[model samples]
Target: MNNDIDSALARFAGAEPHAGLAGLEDRVMCAIASRSSSSGLAMGASLSAAAFALVLGIVSNAVPLAEARAVSTLAPFGAPSPLAPSSLLLEPR
Candidate 1:
């Protein structure tokens, strides 16, 4: 049974190709090449956009921003908290 099936498959595989099959490989290859070329263009465009954003970020950081200052003077607090070790050491034993 295996030999019979093998012989039948061999006969089918040995059959000649049809006329419409001509240049099919070339057409398929051309389609694949066109798709790859479009993807390459899209990749380049995205990379260009990323580079522009990076440059913009660097340039913005290079410039100095405005400085902020306190509007009113600060008053002195009476003493350091007794819980602090330094304050405890300063006190008479």
Candidate 2:
């Protein structure tokens, strides 16, 4: 079945003169090569950097005792002591 269709298409195509693209293929290939050579990159790096910045900001502000290093007590992650004064208002009276 496919052979008959192939023969019919070959006969029909052979009956016509070949009308080749003057420079369209070359132009299209050049365009593809140029695009691949000087390509646009996805924004994964930018997004990762933004996420890192956001995490840093959140960590800096999230822990209330983040800056309390003077107190003797220490959390499991080596964080500041809960008894330490992170703010001026929390200093010993």
TM-score of every candidate: 0.36, 0.28
RMSD of 1: 17.9
Backbone clashes for every candidate come to 0, 0
Model 2's C-alpha root-mean-square deviation from the true structure amounts to 17.4
- The C-alpha stretches of model 2 lying farther than 4 A from their native spots are 1-7, 16-20, 43-93
lDDT of 1 at 64: 52
Model number with the top TM-score: 1
- For candidate 1, the per-residue lDDT at 12 reads 86
Top candidate when judged by lDDT against the true structure? 1
> CA lDDT of each candidate?
0.84, 0.74
lDDT of prediction 2: 0.74
Q: Write the per-residue lDDT of candidate 1 for residues 3-73, one digit (tens) a residue.
A: 98899999989999888999999999999999988897889999999999999999878875867686755
The residue pairs in collision within model 1 are none
> Clashes in model 2: which pairs?
none
Q: Write the per-residue lDDT of candidate 2 for residues 1-93, one digit (tens) a residue.
A: 579889999899888655775688899999999877754453566788899999999987987664555546467566656655573467667
